[model samples]
Target chain A: MKAQSDNLVEAALETLKASTLRVTEPRRALLRLLAEAEKPLSCEEIRARSEGEFDLVTVYRNMEVFREQNIVQTILLESGKQLFELTVEGDHHHHIICRSCHRTLRLELCFGGELERYASSRGFKQLEHKIEVFGLCETCSED
Target chain B: MKAQSDNLVEAALETLKASTLRVTEPRRALLRLLAEAEKPLSCEEIRARSEGEFDLVTVYRNMEVFREQNIVQTILLESGKQLFELTVEGDHHHHIICRSCHRTLRLELCFGGELERYASSRGFKQLEHKIEVFGLCETCSED
Candidate 1:
């Protein structure tokens, strides 16, 4: 899994609290669902996996909040759809997403830190980078 | 410049026609503008730089069409804003966007081709990856 589930729930809640965000039940439930998920999930998928207490809009809003708090990392598909995964503390990696099935595979590889440094030299502060891979997976490729 | 201006206007128009899309005047105008721009531009910026022949909606629709045809690249910023650039024929590169100024810089560095190969070995077909760097640029960092 890209993100480790162990202690993810506790760590995620702690992160929200540290960010001064409210620890509402819905937020807690969202965090728990993401922590247990083996892969990133869309807002629709998140809502389906969630209790009926939260609606689609709530899922979207909460996900956005979580993203800003660094509690979740979002993978943007070529079609502009996004999938959210819980962030394991201090773990930074990319993902390979199947275009057909939308299944995700965690990739341990990341662009080197030199990239951030390169931007730093260009006078950029608070530098960051994002990468996502996309393609047809085995089963879909055979079809 | 990532996209070469030499013959770009003619080439872009021909591309549209070859793709069976209409070679409208607005499209021609946009092609000329982007071919001349040293950097990417947002839709609003594109319209502002336009000849007043096309509205913002026209620029938006045309840019989306260009993206689908691989004639343009869209960089999604952390704030969800997108910057669009004309693609030079056979030219592929990423960008480093400044968070404060919303400006962009072309980066010659790309993740190695081994990434696609790695995904291919993992049973992925037609593999592709996207990378973009983000940070505060010098002017913004000092602000």
Candidate 2:
């Protein structure tokens, strides 16, 4: 697990360098946290888990940069909240979040290709897509 | 077009009332703006188009109420901005927005059923999904 996370951080660092982004310490710390996250994290969670290595504004700033470079993806939740995670290597997945408790689980499935084709037929090009699902998880559903 | 928009506003007012929400003048005006929108409007757009009938904080407060009552749907854009619209009856659709020009067009397609089923099989229930597609529109594709 540690080796996999290390590779993810390394790959992300290369992405930063190729994009001419400075490899600052806070940025690296942020990357490590994302690569190790089971689910995407809110900015507040990032600040808390980061142990004061950076402030909330710095987290937001670095996240904005990461997002622009496609090194990070934001999952906009059902409650109008947003969370961030790294675009990990070879593990493309979406999430199903419990609206009741905010418990999240990854779904190793995607259907973006079909959507892209549909958009392409309408004269859209170079398409990208984001999808999020929300529901009552098993325990919450029984409530 | 005006008649359809009026109908939307009326339906939204019903939703607000059903949810025990107040039918304030500012809320009414905001509903009118959303009903007449060709596409979702950002909070800034809401403020600009509202013509000072209320303030941004007021706009946000009303939107939060409407959102809770399912009177409004927020389309989370690829740029990580959010736009608001009335959840128009019998006109269910998603958007494919232009990254370069910010042009948005509605697509008469959705596959939420498949996603919901996938989540359901995983013991989730009462599923809700949101999808947003981003690409260069025809005009911007050549740029």
Best model number under DockQ = 1
Poorly placed runs, candidate 1 (over 4 Å): A1-6, B1-6
lDDT by residue (A1-143, candidate 2, tens digit) is 99988988998899889976899999889999998987789999999999887789999999989888888888877656778988965667789999988898887668788778889999999888877788899999885
Clashing pairs in 2: none
Candidate 2 displacement at residue B56 in angstroms = 3.5
Which residue pairs clash in candidate 1? A123-B138, A124-B136
TM-score of model 2 relative to the true fold?
0.84
Residues B40-92, candidate 2: write the lDDT tens digits: 89888998998877899998888888887888888877656778888876667
